[model samples]
Target: MFVKLHFEEWIKNEPGVSENTKELIDEAIICYRAQAYRAAYLFSFLSFQNLLKERMLVASCPPGYDEEYWKGIQSELRNDDKWEAKIIECVERERPAQIFNLSVDTKRQYLYWKDRRNDCAHAKSNKIGVSHVESFWLFFESNLSKFGVGGGKEALLEKLKVFLNPAFTPVDSDPTSIIKEIPLTVDSADYLEVIENVYELTTVDIFGPMKTRVWDEMFKLRGEFLDQLVEFIKTNQSLYTQLLKEDPSKVRFFANDPAFIRSLWYEMKMDFRTYKVIIGLLRHNLIPREELNEMISTVSSNNNDTFFFQVEEPDLLVLEESGFFSEFKTLAFVDMKINDFNWARENRNIIWHLIIRNGFDETIVEALNNTMSNSFIPWRLRDSILELFEEFPKLKEEYIDVNSRINGCLPDKLFNSN
Candidate 1:
């Protein structure tokens, strides 16, 4: 009955293990199942040694590889008769550099397995059994992911750039075919750099169209690695602004996870670019209603100004649904935007537009009543704006609850008779 073993099935499915390594391991597993205990031990020991050595030689030495010793290992691996000895020697030479990333415990197990292999190969009296083979198999499974090669970020990027470029890579190419090679080969820091590199392409010529494809594919990175991609988008000032510009389809993914939404919210920067992107992300009702309260909680904690002048009336209405917006907060933000000396008449128009759309309550009306005019816009235009608001019944009250200028600006109304 030709049934596959559990470990054999797992070996086939493990994406981190190289195909060459898996084939080598397959031989060992077959022999062990057949009760060829000595052969199994010999094959198991040699296969792992082969994996480590081959991974070392893949596509040039990555950074942190001991160049001198790497050259020595390269030379020794080429010689058929001495190669196996060189592997054992490499493991023996482990301590000073410990380049394979093996921990103290795994290294100890390797030495123990080597002795067991010697007994099988040298015709020693030591009896080989299922336990010996099983232990070796377990050790192999536990440690295989750690043995990945190409351990340098720069080297990884140098290679990734090649794969990401559409000219060199075929349209039909499964990026996963290349990405599969990336998992253990690259570090988390390398993952972040990869995302940043891809993003820079979007903002430039030649590769702009390809950026989304690359970005969408970047989501393929599993588990903790995916966080790096999100972090890059959330924390980067330019990218924070640019999300509004990214494919709208991505918002579902961006706002998908509660933690991700919270993270994106918390990372919001105090700038128009970040503010616009956050507004865009909040649109289309893509954010789950259940998560809105949490996001509102996030919004309340933010101490920065909302820059609401840029927002439309309907958008403010949308944010209000999530409990993420309040008249008081908008007024405060309105206060800040009104006060910034850099903004001119055009800015004031936008501010008045938002206030009219939301329709002022007593709090907003009173806030406006107490607000004063700034030097940025001429007091006449400010008075015109106030007059426009006052024509509506809600804002008909006389301005200025205080006689003195508020925050060093002139009275909320410079003209009284109108």
Candidate 2:
């Protein structure tokens, strides 16, 4: 009865129509604009059902509204291709109620809200907007209320709120999918585990306690792992080395390879995947910044394009200048450690200056304690440090004392503990 009255009021508002048929036309217009073709059809079909709900139809009027009247409204608008006739069929077939139905799975509702509904409402299409989305909810809510179903409005509302919020946006693709797609070789997991363990060991308790045995095992494992990886690459591509020179894109056989697992290990520390991918691409003479950007976007769709920081040429140049990239890439082959005070003295200026600059004073201090604590003097890079001391001895002394404090040279609260 309410729907009929509402329908009548809507039609009456249509221009150039008799007051009697005006309500019907207005209802059709609502259906047409909302793209509720199926609902329109059903509304026409169940015109009489409105009487039953209203507890009316005392012999003067038939028990229901005229199905014929609703049908004519639908036929008149059938020529519009934008309005699907089956909308009526769908509404009738589903026969969903207007009120909320908490018993129904919310995940289904959430999925529809997050994917289908959101897509329709926001996608590049003719029909889009908050009102359009709200119309569907209203249709369902009205029908559901008749069946005494209720409460999913909150779920629908939550999704609407998220869609409207500036902080959240849906991603068309996922980048971490690549991480999941990477396949592990038989020893790949073990190899990575060993490398991680060794890396951890290097960071903890100076290399003095178990240095000899640990170093031997680490080097041995590194050698074996490298050999196995190289062999795997060779087997996958006959022209392993040449792949680097010719076309790295063609060598994407490693997309699902064990190297990716190792790459993952490094990636967790500092997004080394792009660098590794870049290195692989350079080897193959195929660089696709666009593709790389897509990968980044897929994984992290913030839309700010901040991952641009990773692809920046200047940052890459700085890393190269600092030798950080070379050091990481060749970690397995090199024996790099602050061996003694003399070594620290030789490398102190540039090394410690970099350490402070990067805000890694604690790390450098820890390293110094383990390696250069015993010696009266330690490494300071060539003549540079000496010149610094001569140029400004007081400042140099302060610098040394501050650095020593960082390295835990004293037991006072003037450093990391403080």
Cα lDDT listed for each candidate: 0.59, 0.35
For residues 1-418, write the lDDT of model 1, one tens digit per residue. 7788777876676545567777778788789878998998788788778776766655355455667867877887889898888777765554445455556786788889989998999899999999898888888777766555544445556665775577886655555544554555565545666666666555554234445456656666665466677666766655544554454345555665666555555665544444444555677565566766555445434423334445666667666654455533453454443443334232454345545656544444444444444333445336546666457644443223232333322343544534
Candidate 2 lDDT by residue in tens digits, 1-418:
1355443443233221233333444564466456775444333323312311221111111113245643443443344452233322322322232221223453244334334343443453444444544454444323322221112223222322343233563423221211111111112333444333333433433233332233323222223354444444444332233333333343444444544423322332223233344444434433233343333223222112122233445445544454443442222112223443343343343242343234323443454344433443233432333454466566445545667666556322211222
- Best-fitting candidate, measured by TM-score? 1
Q: What TM-score goes with each of the models? A: 0.43, 0.21
Worst 10 residues of 1 by lDDT: 398-407
Worst 10 residues of 2 by lDDT: 177-186
lDDT of model 1 at position 225: 61
Q: Candidate 2 versus the native: TM-score?
A: 0.21
lDDT of 2 at 372: 36
